[model samples]
Target: MSTAHAYYPSAPMPITMPQKPGYYPTPAHHGYGRVSVSPPQAESVTTSGGASYEPSATSSSYAGSASEYDSSGTNTGVDLLDYMGDRLHGAFDPVPLDRSLAKQAQTSGELNAKHRELLELQALAQRRLAGARANFADGMRAAKEVQKDLQWTQKRVDALNERAARKYPAEYKSAQNRYPAPVDY
Candidate 1:
């Protein structure tokens, strides 16, 4: 007859230690040395003010179940072709009736609007240039008049100096005595 050992659920498992000294000592104790080595009791996590959270039966399977894309997610072949055609035509094909060209044509009537604008700008610039030329000519004339006035004033001063020397011979002689004429002159 075979004998079966009885199992005791309440008893802790036995651990064997090494017999020789210095060969293998006991494992270095953790924070609590030589203390009882039993499995830690399960801790109950609670919220603030000691409120325990108990999940409802329906909550376990409800996450992300209702959120989903529409069933008609696949694109039809015709829709894809139309989308592709639109993109291709927009990239490669020239527009037949451009609004900008139509607007220009309508505004210009017979002459090109851009060309007319250029001509108007050129005429305005020409008018400005002519006015600038007239102003420059007037400035030159004023400068010449000022030069003529300055020459007349200089000639009058020279005449006055000569008359003063002629009228006062004694004073002129005294001035000459003080400052003799240059030898070269």
Candidate 2:
């Protein structure tokens, strides 16, 4: 269990008390900052609706398997308080402190491994985001370039059409007769 001094001092400090009239003394040390502790892990048999964290036969009492709890009267799959009370009072064989410490160390190791994996994933996500941003920029540039090219091509085609009308008047007139200009709205 973790312990820390509470806010709102319970007793007045001797150092803070003024020694003489109109003599204000500064505190040698500051107040204790926030002491954040990780929330207690739930002692659930199952983890987030996943596989059971069944203790070994020696580690636990009154159990054939984790699933056997449903059939057993001792454990109704509820009443965490009662379950802990039973363990504390030795209703079932108590787990050794050293063994419990080892279990905790193992759990810490697993958590560290998971943390590393998560960090790697975060790095990968950052890389992907950077790549996506670059690709977007490249695509935008390409689109703008294509639009400019299309405008230039259209201008060139109009110039060619004008030239054709002037140079091949007879042919152009025949073509215009075959395909009349579209009516404006």
Candidate 3:
């Protein structure tokens, strides 16, 4: 609400006289200052399409929700009035303030819980990854040991064949003639 004073020494201090709905005083009339326009009355506004609408929602079903919005006379001196100064147009209306706030709080709590759960899952995945890496390293070491054992056995077989060929060339030559290829162990 703008409190720009419209003073006339002959009339009143603020000129509390009601002005027309859309009418505005010139800057010169109000001493070249800003003037606040009055609010529209609690009436239906008509459009060019012959349609009209009320400012606030009003219905027979409003009775059920009215109890939720009505104040318990706890607020003492606050003047709650609409633009047209209608009591029925202002404070009596009920809103879902409390229930909406509670729902919002519940949603916030659920979101926080989900965030915590996601963090825990990520941590567990990291631990599992570390364990898998360690297991893979151990398996590679074991494979290297097995390869070393296989190489040692193949070396011993070749050494034994060389010794036999030198000690008994005639016998080895006859065996080679009989079996041209090396025998499988």
Candidate 4:
């Protein structure tokens, strides 16, 4: 088997794009885009007498009372000129506004939103820190208990050695000469 080291680029290569001209539809100053103000085209109809006549606007299906239109105040049935005329005749009122006050309110609202996010992150960090500290304390207590148990065991072993030396003095002295006491105990 061949041992080959694979190399990977740390960053991707930059892409080069050709510059081209782009077109966008022009937007109207008011209302929906590009309103058509042209009059409707008439369709010619031939009767049994072979005479052709164009249809009239009033003869169409929409020739009814003004109230027959939608009552939502939109006046979709009215002509564009008439609609604009009615609107200009004090049908709508302009409200006075202080732009500086509006800007200040918006900034304060954004500041409050950011402050809430900061507090949430701070609370999460505090909870994680508390958990880490508690875990560390529990580990330290466990290590201390293990050390205490080791000291108790070492004391018991020393006591057994003392008893053995007293009971058989001749053999104990020879064993002591071969292996000295451990320095830590």
| TM-scores for all predictions | 0.32, 0.40, 0.42, 0.36
Kindly list the per-residue Cα lDDT of model 2 for residues 1-185, writing each as its tens digit. 22222232222222111123222332223222112122222232333464333333123332333543232232222233333444455564546877899999999999999999999999999999999999999999999999999999989988987999999999999998999877979
As for TM-score, the candidate ahead, 2 or 4, is 2
Candidate 1, superposed: residue stretches over 4 Å from native: 1-111, 168-185
Kindly report which residue stretches of model 2 are placed more than 4 angstroms away from their true locations once superposed: 1-97, 166-170, 173-185
How good is model 4 by TM-score? 0.36
lDDT of 1: 0.51
Alpha carbon lDDT of each predicted model: 0.51, 0.54, 0.53, 0.55
Candidate with the greatest TM-score versus the true structure: 3
Worst 10 residues of 3 by lDDT: 6-15
Look at candidate 2 and tell me the lDDT of residue 3. 25
The alpha-carbon lDDT assigned to residue 10 of candidate 1 equals 24
lDDT of 4 by residue, 2-28 (tens): 222223222222222222223232222
**For candidate 4, which ten residues in a row score worst on lDDT?**
10-19
lDDT at residue 86 of model 4 (Cα atoms): 47
Select the stronger candidate by lDDT from 1 and 2.
2
Q: What is the lDDT for 45 in model 1?
A: 38
RMSD of 2: 31.1
